[model samples]
Target chain A: MPSIDVCYSPELLHLYELEGKAVVAVDILRATSTMVTAFAHGATDIIPVMQLEECRAYAEQGCLTAAERNGIKAEGFDLGNSPFAYMNGQVKDRTVAITTTNGTRAIRMSEAAQEIIVGAFLNLEAVAQHLRELQLDVLVVCAGWKGKFNLEDTLYAGALAERLQGEFEFENDATLASLYLYHAAKDDMVTFLRQSSHVRRLENLEIHKDIEFCLQHDTYNVLPVWKRDRLVNLKEFESLGV
Target chain B: MPSIDVCYSPELLHLYELEGKAVVAVDILRATSTMVTAFAHGATDIIPVMQLEECRAYAEQGCLTAAERNGIKAEGFDLGNSPFAYMNGQVKDRTVAITTTNGTRAIRMSEAAQEIIVGAFLNLEAVAQHLRELQLDVLVVCAGWKGKFNLEDTLYAGALAERLQGEFEFENDATLASLYLYHAAKDDMVTFLRQSSHVRRLENLEIHKDIEFCLQHDTYNVLPVWKRDRLVNLKEFESLGV
Candidate 1:
C-alpha cells in the first residue's frame, strides 16, 4: 500500500523527502479554496505567484491579478484572495495570477514533487477521489499561518486520511491523530473551527464568511495542478503526462 | 481576565508578539516530559541549547549533556531526550545541558516573553496550580514537530485551557479546539497518541514506550523556566520578581 503522511504545517516540508510522492497542497483558510472556485468558474488557468511583486508583474502581462496581505484586498490587484471574488463572474478562458501569504508559498515549494494537487474542504470528495485513483504515496502539506501549523489544515488532512484509510497506510501518529480530530469535528466543522487561530485573525479583519465558505465540501470538482511555473487544471497536465 | 491563547504549533510563534505574555511551552512527544523527569530526579538545571555543539560545550563545563535528534538519542551524549533517562537516580542533583530538534528551539525563541514555562502531560496539574497562583496572560506554545503543529501539543494546550477556564479568556479557536481534543482523548491518552506522527516516528526507532510514559498526567510538579540562556526552575526567576 502507498504510505500516506501528513505534513502538519508547511515548515515540515523540509523534513519530508518528496522523491516519488504525490503532494496535496492544502490551504483551507483561503488559497486552495479560491483556486478551486476559480477553476470551477471556468478560468483557463490560475497562476499561483509566491510574491506580490511577481503577481503584479504577471498582471502587467495582461492577466487578471488577485493579491492580498493580512486578509484585505491589495489596492492595485484585480481581486483579493477570496473565493467569493473568484465566483463573482464567469471567468471562462481568462487567465488569473494570484498571490497570498501562505498558500502560494506552498505551491511554489512543491514544485519538486512528482505531482502536486491543490486540496481544500470545498472540494473534499473530489480530492479524496483523486487520491484514491492516483494510488501513489501521498503527502498532505498544510499551509499553516506563516510557516506554522494551524487547526483547519491539519483537520482537513485528518479527514482526507479517514477517507483514504483502506487505500493507504498511515506513516505517522500525527496523521492518525488528525484523523481522530476530523471524526470528532466532521459533524460540526463550523462550530469546531469558529474559534481557530486563523479564523480569529481573519475575524479581526471581519472575514468570517470566508471561513464558512471554505469549509463547504465538494463545492467544486475541478482539480488545480501546478505546471510550468503556474497552477493549471489536471487536464492541462495530462497532455504532457506530468 | 488574562488572555489564554493556544498556539497550535511552534511555527505560529511569529504570530505572537510575546510582549507581555507567559508562554507555556508544551511538547508532549518528549522534551517537556523529559524536562519534568529531569527536575523530578533532582537535576539542578537544564540549559536548553538549540545546537548539538552547545550541549558538547556545556559538557566541557563539567555538566552532563543530553541530545535528541528525530526523537532518538545522539550517540555521544550522556543521555537521550527521553523521560526514562531522566528518572529518579539518573539525573539527581546534577546540572545538565540539553538539545533537541523542536522543544529547545521553542525555549530559545520564547526568551523574550514575560515568562516561559515548560509544560507536558507529566506536569499538567502543577502547571494548572501555577497558573491559578499567577495573573499574567498565558500563551500556550505547542512545540509542534519541527516547528509545525502536532496533535499532542495542541491537545495539551487545550487541556490547560480547560483547566484554566473561567480564570482566563479564550483568545482563539485553537484553544477551544485543543480543549475539545483533550476532553475527547481524556479517557485514553495513550491510545489517543498511539497513532500520532511523532509517536509513529519514535516507534520506528523502537521507542514507542516513551510515548506512553510521556502522556501520563501529574507525574511531576517541577515547572521548567528559561533563565539567562538556560531552562532552569521557575523559582530561579522568582528572585527577579518576574
Candidate 2:
C-alpha cells in the first residue's frame, strides 16, 4: 500500500525524500487553484516560473502571463493569481506562464518527484481519484506563506488525506494532523478559515471573492499535471484516450 | 497584547524573529520532560549541549552527563533521556550536562530570544503562568524529530496555546491549527498519540512508561529557564529572594 504524507512548507521540502513519489503541490488560496481553473476553462498549458521576469519573458513567445506578489497582481502582467482572471474565455486555447509568492516555488522545488500534480480544493476529488488509480506514494506539498506554515494549504491536504483514507496509509504524523484539522474544519470551512492569518491578510487586500472561490470543493474535474516544462490537464488528456 | 506563535520545527526557526520573544522550547517525548524532572528532583543546573562529546566533557569538571541519540541513551553516559533517571534522589543538588537528538538543538538555536525556557507537560501550567507574568510575545518551538515535524511536540504546542488563549493573541495559523489539534487530542492523549509516528517509534523501543509519564499535566511547579550558560529552576531562584 502507498502512504500519504504532507510537507507543510516548501522550506522544509529538503527533509523529505521525494524520489519516486507523486508530489501534489497545493496553494489553495490561489496558485494551484488558478492552474486548475485555467485547465478547466480550455487553456492549453501553463509554464510555472519562479520569477516575475521569467513569467513576463514568456509573453514574447505568445504565452499569456500571470504574476502575483504578496497577494497583489504584479504591474504589467496580463492576469493575477485569481482564478476569475482565467475565466470567460480570456485564456481559451492559449498557453500561460505564471509566477506567485509561494505556489510556484513549491512546484519548482518538487521537480525531483516521479510526478508533479497541481492540486486544489477546486479539483479535490479529481486529484484523489487519479491518485487512487496511480497507486503511488503521495506527498502533498502545502505552499505555505513566506516559507512558514499556513492554514489553507494544510486544510486542503487534510481533505485529500481524508478522501484517500483506507486505501492509503499515513506513515507520518503530518498526515494524521492534517486529517484531524480537515475534520474540525470541514463542516464550516469559511468560518473556520476566517481565523487563519493568510485569510485575514487576503481579506485586508479585498480578495474575498478569490478566497471564497478557492475554498469551493470539487468545482472542476481537472488535474493540472507537470509534463517537462508546463502543466497540462491530465484528466482531459486521459479522456481523449491519449 | 503580546501574541503567540509556534515554530513547528527547529529547522524552520530561521523564518521567525526571536530577538524580543520568550521562547518555550518543548520536546515532550523526553528531553524537556527529563530536564523538568531533574530540576524538580533537586538538580542544581543543566547545561544543554548539542554533541555527546560536549556533554561527556562536562564529567571531567564534576557535572553529570546525559546523552541520547535516536531515542536511545549514548554509551557511557550517566543518564538517558528518561525522566525516571532523575527520580529517587539520583541527581540531587548536582549540576548536569545533557545532549539529545532534537531538544538541546532547539534550545541552542533559540539563544537569540530574550529568554529561553524548557517546557513539557510535566511543567505545563507552571510555564504558562511564567509566560503570563513575563507578558512578552511567545514563540513555542517544538523540538521536532530530526528537523521534521512530529505529533508529540505539536500536541504540546497545541496544549500550551489552548492554555494561553485569551491573554495571548495568535499571530499565525500554526497556533490556531495547534489549538484545534489539542482540543481534538486533549480527552485521550494516549489514544490520540498512538497514531503518531514518534510514539509508535518509541513504543517499538519499549519506553511505554516514559510516554505515560510525560503526558501528565502540571506534575511539577518548576520552570527550567536558561540564564547565560545553564538551565536553573526559576521557581527555586525566585524563592531564594536573589
Candidate 3:
C-alpha cells in the first residue's frame, strides 16, 4: 500500500516528497467547503486563482468572483467566503473564481503532486472515495492561516486520514496525531471546534452559519479535482465534452 | 493573563516572536525524559549541544557524552537516547554533554527565547507550574523529527497547555488542537500512542520500554531549565557555585 502523510501547513510543504503523490488540498473553514459547495450546487466550474488580480480578471470577464482576506470578503466581489453563496441555485451552470487567504495559496504551492483535489467536511465521503479509487499515496495539505497551523484544516485532514487509514500506510507523525483527533472529536465537530482559533476569529465576524455549514458531514457527493487550470467535479468532469 | 501558543515543530520556531516569551521545549519520545531522569538521578548538569563535535569537545574534557542519530545511539557515545541510561545512579554528580536526533537541535534552534525549559511527560506538572510562575507568554516548541511534525511532542505540549488553559488565552489553532488532544488522551496515553509512527518505528528497533517510561506522568519532580548554556534542575541549579 502507498503511504499517507500530512503537511500541517503550507509552510512545511517542502518537507514532504509530493512528486508522485496525490495531494488532498483542504481548507475546511471556507475555501474548499465553498469550492465543494459550488460544484455540488451545479456551478459549471471554479477557477482557484492565487492572486487577487487573477480573480479580478475573472470577475471582469463576467464570471462570479469571490475573494476573501483576513476573514472578510473582498470588496466589490459578488460573494464573500460564505458557503451559502454557492449553495442555492444561484450558481447553477455558472463559473466561480475564488481567491482566499489560505486555500488558494495551498493549492498553488502543492502543484507538484500528481493530483490536487479539494476536500472539506461537506464532501468527506466524496473526497475519500475519490482518493480510494486513485489508490495513490495521499498527502493532506492543510491551508493554514498565512503559513501557520490551524485546527479546522488539520481536523479535516485527520478525518480523511482516518477514512483512508487501512488502505494506506500511515508513515508520518502528523497522520497519527490527526487520526487520534478525528476519533476524539468525531462525535461533535461544531462543539469540538468551538474553542479553535479560526472558529472564534470567524465568530467575532458574525459568520456562525458559515462555520456550522462547513462542519456538516457528507452533504455533497462531489470531489473537486484541479485539472487543466480549474476545479471541476470529479464525477462530472470525467464525462464532460466526450 | 499570558497567551499560550504551540509551535508544532521547531521548523515553525521562526513563526513565533520568542524574544520575550518563555519556551517549553518538548521532545517527549526521549530527549527531555532522559534529561529529567538525569536530573532526578542527581546529575549535576547537562550541556545540550547541537553539533556532534561540540558534544565531543565536552566528552574530551571528561564529561559524559550522549548522542543519538536517526533514532539509534550515535557511534562511540556514552549513551544512546534512553531515559534508563541516566537512571541506576550512573551519572550522579557528573556533568553530561548530551545531543540527540531532535531535542538538542530544537534547544539550539530556539536560543532566541528568553528562557528554555525541558518538558516531557515525566515532568509535565513541574514544567506547567514553572510556566504559571513566570506568567510570560508561552510557546511550546515540539522538537519534531527533522523539521517535520510528530505526535508525542505535540501531545506533551497539549498536556501542558491544557493544564494552564484558564490562566492563559489560547492564541492559535495548533494550541487548541493540542489541548483537546491532551484532554482526550489524559486517561490512556500509552494505548493512544501505540499506533503512532515514531512508536512503531522505535518498537521495531526494540525500545518499547523507553516509550512506556517516557509516557509516565510526573514521575520526576525535577524541572530542567536552560540557563547560561546548560540544562539544570531549576530547584537546585540556583544553589550551585557561581
Candidate 4:
C-alpha cells in the first residue's frame, strides 16, 4: 500500500524526494480548476510555462495564451485567471499556453516526479480513482500563494484525503490535519471558505461567481497530466491500461 | 486589539517580522510542558541553550542541566525530557540549563521578538491571560520537531486560538486549521494522538506517559517568560501589576 502526504506549500517541496512518487498538484482557488475546465471542454493541450517568455514562445506558435498575476489578467494575455473563460468556444479544439502566479510555478517545479496530475474539486472522483489505480505513493503538492500556505489548496488536499482515507496510509501531521479540515467543512464549502484570506482577497476583485464555480465538486471528470511540458487529459492513456 | 497568528513550525518564523510582536513559543510534547512544570515547582530560572556545549557551559557555572535528543536523555545530563522530573523536587528553587532537539532551538531562534513566552496546555490559562494583557500582536510559534510541523505543538497552538478567538484577529489559514484540529481532538487527546507519526515514534521508546502529561490542561498557572538570557515565571512580575 502506498502512503499519502501533503506538502503544504511549494516551499516545502524540497523536503520530499519525488523521484518515483506520483504527484498531484492542487491550486483550487483558480489555476488547476481552470486547467481542469480547459480539458473538460474540447481543448487538445494546455502547456504550463514558468515564465511569460516561455508562455509567449508557445503563443508565437499560434497557441491561445493566458496569464494571471496578483489576481488580475496579465496585460497582454487573452485570458485571465477565470475558469469561465474556458467554457466559451475560444478554447474548443485549440491549445492554450498559460502561466499563473502560483500553479504553473508549482507544475514546473514538480516535473521531476514520476507523474504530475492536476487535481481540483472539479475532478475529485476521477483523481481519487486514478491514484487508486496507480497504487503508488502519492504526494499532494499545494501551490500556495507565493510560497505561503493558503486555505483553499489545503482544503482541497484534505478533500482528496477524505475520499482516499482507508485506501492509503497517511504520512504526516499535515495529512491528518487536512483530513480533519475536510470533514469539518464538507457540509457547505462556500460558507466554510467565507472568511478565508484568499477567498476574501478574490472577493475583493468581484469574482464571487468564479469562487463558487471553482468550489463545486466533481463538476468535471478530466485529470490533466503534466507530460513533456504540456498538460493533457489523463484518460487518453487509460485505454493503454496505464 | 492585538491580532494572533500560529506558526506551525520554526520554518515559518521568517514569514512574519517579530520586531514589535509578543511570541508565545510552544513545544507541547516535552519542552514547554516541562518548563511550565519547572515553574509550578518554584524553579527560579531556566536558560534554554541550542548546543550541548552551551548547556555544559551553564552547568559549569553551577546551574542544573537537562538535555534530550532522539527520544533519549543526553549521556551525562541531569535530566531527560520528562515533565515529571520538574514536578519532583529536582527543579525547586534551582536554576536549570536545558537543551532539546526542537523546543529550545525555537526559543533561540525567536530572540528577535519584543517578548518571548513559553506556552503549553499545562499553563493554557496563564499564557492566554498574559497575552491578553500584553496588548501586542501575538505569534504562537510552535517548536515543531526539527523544523517540521508536529501534532502536539499544533494542537496546543489551536487550543490557544480557541481560548483567544474573539479577542483577536486570526492572521492566516494555519491559525484556522490549528483551531479546527484542537476542536477535533478536544474530547480525548491521548486517543486522538495515538495514530500520529510523532506520538507513535515516541511510543516506540516507551515514554507514553510523557505524552499524556503534556496534554493535560490547567495543570499549572505558571507562565515562563524569556528575560535577560533566562526564563523566569511571569508571576515574578505580577507584583508590579504587569
Highest lDDT scorer: 2
| Model 4 CA lDDT for position A179 | 82
Q: Write the per-residue lDDT of candidate 2 for residues A141-212, one digit (tens) a residue.
A: 999999999989999999999999899999698999999999999998988999988899999999888888
Q: Give the CA lDDT, 0 to 100, for residue B60 in model 4.
A: 78
Q: Could you give the DockQ of candidate 2? A: 0.81
Instruction: Tell me the lDDT of model 2 at A201.
Output: 90
Rate residue A40 of model 2 by lDDT. 87
Query: Per-residue lDDT tens digits of candidate 1, residues A121-168?
Result: 767777788888888899989887787557788788988888888889
Judged by whole-model lDDT over C-alpha atoms, candidate 1 comes out at 0.79
Off by over 4 Å in 4: A236-242, B236-242
Tens-place lDDT digits, model 1, residues B1-242: 88788776666677777978888987778888888788877788888888898789888798889999987789899999878777647677689898888888777878778888899877787788788787888988878776555778877887888889889888565676677788888899777776576666777888777887877777776778777777776532111110
**Alpha carbon lDDT of residue A4, candidate 3?**
82
The DockQ value obtained for model 1 is 0.41
Error of 1 at B48 (Å): 3.5
Clashing pairs in 2: none
For residues B8-51, write the lDDT of model 3, one tens digit per residue: 88777777799998988889879888888888888888999887
Candidate 1: the clashing residue pairs are A173-B195, A173-B196, A173-B197, A174-B196, A174-B197, A195-B173, A196-B173, B42-B93, B158-B179
Clashing pairs in 3: none
Interface RMSD of candidate 3? 1.7
Q: lDDT of all predictions, in order shown?
A: 0.79, 0.91, 0.84, 0.85
Ranking by TM-score: 2, 4, 3, 1
In order of listing, the candidates' clash counts read 9, 0, 0, 0
Task: List, residue by residue over B138-216, the lDDT tens digit for candidate 2.
Answer: 9999999888888889889989988998899996899999988989999999999998889999999999999999999
* TM-score per candidate, chains pooled: 0.84, 0.97, 0.92, 0.94
Top candidate (TM-score): 2
